[model samples]
Target chain A: MHDLDVLGVIFILGLTCYAMRAGGYVLAASMRDDGIAARFLRLAPGNLFIAFIVGGCLSGGLAGLVGTMVALVTMAVTAREWVALSAGFGAAIATSAIAP
Target chain B: MTAAGFRRGLVAALPFLLSNGAAGLVMGLTYKGLGLGASHAILFSLLVYSATAQAITLSMWASPLPVAAMVVACIATNSRYLLMGAHLRQLFGGLAPRKILLSLFLLADASWLMTSSDADRNGPDAGYLLGSSIPMAIGWVGGTALAYAAPLATNGPLKLAAALLPTMFIATLLPSQWKNAASPWPWLISAVVALLVSHFVDPSWSMLIGGGCGTLVSMMERTDA
Candidate 1:
């Protein structure tokens, strides 16, 4: 492969991601602290990430399902992110190893 | 670049490095499995810094790479950032354009979430944002390097790393503060919408739809008040 080819891909992909992120700020520069809009923005992060997590789990299948539940229960009971995460990771690893 | 900002950012970002490292390790392993060179993996992480985009690119690794398709896929996968950026702008738009632009560079969803949640109490702090981002960026790049440089065993434990990304999200969103903040209905509705849309439509779009609908439900509550 040509050296220039790799650079070209990086340039295109990097620029695209950067543009989408920066462009949103530019477009919304004039936005005021409108009540509804602010509320939406405030809620957006939690909502978006939650949705993304759901989608990620879908792709994860059984491992995702079991891991997520384990993590949720652990977090609820212990309130320790690391512990919850370890439980989830161990479940996923074990499930994948035995099943796959 | 105040010392305080850097310190806070670094501290805030340190916890997330684990999840980011896991993600980067997976990407690195995938690239290595594809037989790409270390330089290729490093460059991809440095430039893209996106697991979804890099994962898609990995699927298309070939002699004559489908460069165009890969670019399209990257853009489509990253479109969620648009909403993230909007959220950030609303929180911190008063800052100088340069600082805001700089923060946007290498911004990850986890950082955005952490920063946004912080903005609720302390106003927009570029220093904090930068602090958090530095460690995360390092984790991603360093994790990729470790994967290639060391060539660790690819067993069930390694594959389990993939699950960390989503679990990280759960950890971030399900903290006691968030749980006590409000009713669970909005989050539940959003998850169901996202799950169904992801099943029927392209999973990428499910994020926007679920978040959009969930935010709308939240707005309705605001209206009722």
Candidate 2:
């Protein structure tokens, strides 16, 4: 085992992230206005956002799941981001406090 | 950028800053625990500017560094940003190369979402994009510095605070987008696939796979319709 060069690792990681971020713009230039890819991009963010949180919520266990449900229901009903977030956080914190 | 525009962006990003800060604090403490110095942690936060990517980097850091493995790991975790940038094509698509470079370099999920939502609701403004980005950069880098200067545990109140962060994206999505969703099947399928992938595959690749699957399904549905 050997300690890696800290700065080198950071540089490579940073460059990789930049490439991924910029690569989208380069590829997007070819996207037709009404193309399938265009439509996909339009709806992809929300779906991707959902996917991003799935693991986090699942790992949080039952409390996390309940909290997520509360948040989703609150958002659906009230359409208020903050209020829904509060409901979710309240559930998570309360559940953690009681169970942890 | 107009002062008002910039201020509005900053205010809009404030709540996100809190969540980002909590995550940053945890990361900073982790770096310290790993025997990395404060300067190194700060540089890492500034350059990478992603809590998830930073976390993956930290986990991947080991003897001999497994540099190739770490690169692949970061790519898998961050492939979402590619889609995010594509989403912004309509907004940043027309800008000069230099301007686009600056904006894309600073972009993150929170800023990208806020900027895109703002464009959809209120029309795209370059200033708004910068407005949203600057605050997030501050929150992320500032949070790391604060945490390195004063380390904090990941659990306890911090854990609860961190727990609350992910749902913000869902809340952002449902308020306006959910009502307008042509069919909920794509999202449902994506979420289920993501859950399954998270269980079987490395969590790092789950989001990209799930998102790709969701996008493909949605495209196919659109074609069918």
Candidate 3:
């Protein structure tokens, strides 16, 4: 494809992304704060985050699993993100080296 | 819009410079391998600004690009943002809409998680949200440009480790999301459902489906109780 066509495609995709990012906020603005929709929104983040972790772990395999566990434990213990992330990265790299 | 919150957020997000930069470097290498020029690759990273969307779209890239299908795939993969945005409204409802909307441009999963956790403790600070998001954007866009220019030959283990960063970052937030006895049930359900959905359907849809199902169960449990 030509450079211009690629740019056009990227632009369109960008618009689509921004729309999704903004769409729910705009729609939610009109809803009653105490409604069921609000309840669902309140309950959604944790579930969504859990699902993300599961999907990520499954795709990432054992190394991913171990790394995430280490990260979670580190966070739980230290409450430091940088420490957890560094530890997790180290664990994942070590696991990958051993297994791969 | 407190400068203090913004400064704290920026400092807190400094770690993403390493995590996001590593992941973005891998993406840049992939884009280069796909024959994309530096300008195009950088633009894609800037405009799309989503690792999941860009990764999925890259899998579908071909000559006479499948524009319609790509758009559909992008929507499907990014649908989580809709839920996130809705929840953001609940958190930052009192903030100026224009400011919120502009800040949403740089919103990312890690930054969103960080902002949500912060809000739970410090109340909603739009400045923190915007502040944290900036470094993530920089790490991603700058890393792409840097990788394109350098094209470093990264090894397998190093790349795998880098790829795990986002997930690891999210994993760190899991503790804060826990509410009480009921939290574990929904989280377990979400994990099981996500695993099944990822196995059966497209992996991209797993989070929305699994998370939605879990949330429904939580609501039903609440009603029953």
- Binned by DockQ into CAPRI classes (incorrect, acceptable, medium, high), candidate 3 is acceptable
- lDDT ranking from best candidate downward: 3, 2, 1
Local accuracy of candidate 1 as per-residue lDDT tens digits, B57-108: 5544555666765665565456657667777777776776676788788688
Q: Give the worst 10-residue stretch by lDDT in candidate 3 chain B.
A: B174-183
Give the count of colliding residue pairs in each prediction: 2, 1, 0
Assess the local accuracy of residue B141 in candidate 1 as a C-alpha lDDT between 0 and 100: 86
Candidate 3 residue runs with Cα over 4 Å from true position:
A1-13, A24-29, B1-41, B50-104, B107-136, B179-181, B223-225
Q: How accurate is candidate 1 locally (lDDT)?
A: 0.68
Give the per-residue lDDT digits (tens) of candidate 1, residues A1-42.
Answer: 765777678777778778867766776755444545444545
Error of 3 at B44 (Å): 4.0
Q: Summing lDDT over every window of 10 consecutive residues in candidate 1 chain B, give the lowest-scoring window.
A: B172-181
Q: Which tens-of-lDDT digit does each residue in B1-225 have in candidate 2?
A: 356766778788877677767656656766766777778888899988876577545544556676775676566556667767767776766765566767788889778888888888777766777788887887778787887676465566555655445444344455454542567787788789988887787654676578668767776774422
Please compute DockQ, using alpha carbons, for every candidate against the native two-chain complex.
0.43, 0.43, 0.47
- Best model per lDDT: 3
Model 2 interface Cα RMSD in Å:
5.1
Q: What TM-score does model 3 achieve against the real structure?
A: 0.65
